[model samples]
Target: CVNCGKLKADLNDTSFADKVKHARDPKTRMSVVWNYCKTKTICETDAIEETDPDMPDEAAPVKKGHGGCGHVQPQIRKEGLKLFLQYKKT
Candidate 1:
């Protein structure tokens, strides 16, 4: 439900919706959502220096040696956001 909450919050913000409108795929849209979540959680103690700003916060905290799960969660979250938006528009 966290992802749904995040998506709704983003959708209510005109600027955020505008930013994501050009994202044609789940992967690309996930990047936008991920970056937004990261910015909301950023703190001084988070060791952000080693992480790429463009990487999702979920993907950032992990070390380089670990293999990521191919971003399936992000794709799912993106789909949820799209569905919610479609429902809202109608």
Candidate 2:
């Protein structure tokens, strides 16, 4: 994840977007985003649109995906006062 430096989770209006909307400052917004992203188990992937080879202009609607590093995500834990990453089989 650090190597690619990409967010593990994709943004959505249901949860992440709604929480960020009420954040009053950048710091608060950052935490809000981080909290939502940290729990994701896998990295987001790009959606592939299926197009008709015969009809070049015809295509399907966008699928669910994004441009993110396809890497396993680690869970962040707060143990007492120390913060660490917990890795397990994903």
> Model 2 — TM-score against the truth?
0.60
Error of 1 at 15 (Å): 1.4
Error of 2 at 86 (Å): 4.5
Cα lDDT computed for each candidate against the true fold: 0.46, 0.71
Off by over 4 Å in 2: 12-14, 54-65, 76-86
What does each candidate score in C-alpha RMSD? Answer: 15.5, 4.0
Given candidate 2, what's the lDDT at residue 12? 52
Residue 82 lDDT in candidate 2: 98
- Per-candidate TM-score against the hidden true structure: 0.35, 0.60
Q: Worst lDDT window (10 residues) for model 2?
A: 56-65
Q: Model 2, 1-90: lDDT tens per residue?
A: 654777665665467667888898999998988777766777766765667777655354555665777777676789899989877863
